[model samples]
Target: MKKKIISLFIILTCLFSSFPFILAAQNLKLVSNYALEDPRNLFYLDNNVYVADGTNGLKIVNVGDPNNPQDQGSYSVSGVCFDVFVAGDYAYLANGITGLQILDVSNPLLIDEMGSVVDSNYAWGVYVVDDYAYMADSDDGLEIIDVSDRENPVEVAESSSGGYAEDVFVLDGYAYLAEKSQGMRIVNVTTPTSPTSLGVFNDGSDIYGVFVEGDYAYLAAHGSGLIVVDISDKNSPSKVTNIAFDGMAREIFVENKIAYVAARSEGLILVNCTDLDTDLTVMAKLDDNSETGSGDAGVYVADNYAYVVDQEKNSLQVIDLTASGGGNIWLWILIPAILAVVVLIVRKSTAKKEPSRKEKLSDEEVEEESNEDGEESAVVGIEESESEKEEIELKSIPEEAEDSQEKSEESEQSE
Candidate 1:
């Protein structure tokens, strides 16, 4: 009985331990592509794709059919558009030196400029939440704009303490800024007009983009690759780990423990960050040679496709991420193991109740049966011992197979 219980516990442990690896090895394939000019950044809403086409302004593409993306319309802006954020009926753009440009994108074909807040500092990124728009103005820190009035956008507050803010991501009531050469800065934006600094984390790397999910902030550090920071304590953010890449890391989009990175020379690189407590590992990479560009500017994942902007290719390439691979193998292994454990537990419980029925016998009858039924008792005990031995052997099969696989992988890497 003790041996059987130990075997069951081992099987359950192995079944639960494979979850992270099961989610890490996802298979991805190129679905389709749409040609455009100098596409810098992109955002997907409903079924439409709004791209920040450099010098060409905003380009809208209908992705209702990902296999054949159609160009719906485009609106030209004054400055070189870098980033875009769509909210309700308006599309807010970070228009370089032109500052923040609000457009009425309710009608895709005729996207008219609703308002503009021209500033001296160049705008690199924009994030809109509620009635306010946060702009990461280069060398000028963060700028808060009031978009309550679409036609007349106003700048209510500005913070220039964190030098050269390149990107901003807001969550809850705090705004996270990717400060160039300054790492990251957290600002409390509960009051839109008078934002206060909560904390700053400088790891001596140039941060180009920032994405906040849960209690962690994933930063794209130019030459430093990807840096994960623990923001659970807003007052004191600390670096967790830094994953280096072959090329410069410009932007990142994370979904389901997978990070889609826009690496300059490497194109779209997929990373497995399922275990963030340790170093991040590169699972797959779609290099520039796979496409046409040396510069992969932005990435956005939705449904099961990763939308990437290839600057030199002048197009948007959609990569399919729904293909089955190693995850299926883990699923197949786990299901049967779980069912087997459940069956063993039921059998063990049933066997324990079977002995209770014999308790009704008188003491003299029990003694007589013990002497007369000695052979039957011995047979039952032998059967149980055989069952436990079989279960223990079954528990060792997966452990041995796992060891063999690890050895094979190590040998291949060494060679």
Candidate 2:
């Protein structure tokens, strides 16, 4: 009975626990592609893919129709543009050594530079929240800029991370910095002008990109794959878990707890991070075998389509995530329910077969069983007694024969 209770409890727990994955499960497939020159990283906004085409500059592609993407515009810059962040009417570019370049993108056809801020080191990544722009300046660490005035963006403050800051993500007044070899650094950026370090989580993995949502920060830890960090407690952030793959995880984008990874060597890999308590699940993978690209460098997911930029193939590949079916919430629920019912029925059948000791027996039935047991014992005792009597009689007969022989010998001697 105890064992049955335990098994039922375990089954129920598993059924309830799987709800998160069932609700968030999805698969991906390559739907379309757009050619480019040395594309590195990309950002998706309002159905448009803004790609940082490495020395070729920023190329904008509209992916309103995932099946067929079209080039919308192009803006060339002096240095190698590594990253881009579009906000409102402007687009911010993290142009390597050339520093930050802000562009007025109100008109997609005619893009023009609105402002610029030079960086001492390479500007690897950029993130904009409100009026401030946060940059991951390679060797120089985290650089903050005031972009309230797009025409004249000013240098506000700077925070030095111990290693090369490759990417930065801001969420709930904190800046999560992904430093190449130094792991991750959490900073309190509530005061943009006076940023302070809260904590650091390093497991010796090289972090290339970071994306924070809610209380967790997802990192593209290059060869280490996708690592999830617990940022719920800012003062002491910790590494929660990680999912490894063959490719070099370059950039990561999370939408609705699904992490889309641009695994350079392995192409695009999608992970189901809905249930953090369990091992991260790989929902789908689109390798480099297709026209999508050879070495995927960047990825951005929006409206069921994943936009991946291939640095080697120098093209943008649009993947349809809904082509492969997702786990129907109703189906998931029904499966567990059916299993539970089957388990109950089997248990009930087994219980019926094995009568419980607690069940009361009728007085007449009990008396009849007791009489039958007594009769069996009596028969066994009578058989044993008969065998012992037979052995005694046989021994007595041998003694009598010997006495008769002695009497015959005595009579013969007397004669």
Task: Judging by lDDT against the true structure, name the best candidate.
Answer: 2
For candidate 2, what is the total of clashing residue pairs? 0
TM-score computed on alpha carbons, candidate 1: 0.73
TM-score for each of the candidates: 0.73, 0.74
Query: Which lDDT tens digits does candidate 1 get at residues 41-159?
Result: 99989888899998999999988888889998899888999999999889999999999999999999877888999999999999999999999998889999999998999999988
Q: Name every residue pair that clashes in candidate 2.
A: none
Error of 2 at 20 (Å): 20
User: Which regions of candidate 1 deviate over 4 angstroms?
Assistant: 1-27, 290-293, 324-415
- Scored against the true structure, residue 157 in model 2 reaches a CA lDDT of 89
Candidate 2 wrongly placed segments (more than 4 Å):
1-27, 290-294, 324-415
Task: Evaluate all candidate structures by whole-model CA lDDT and list the values in order.
Answer: 0.84, 0.84
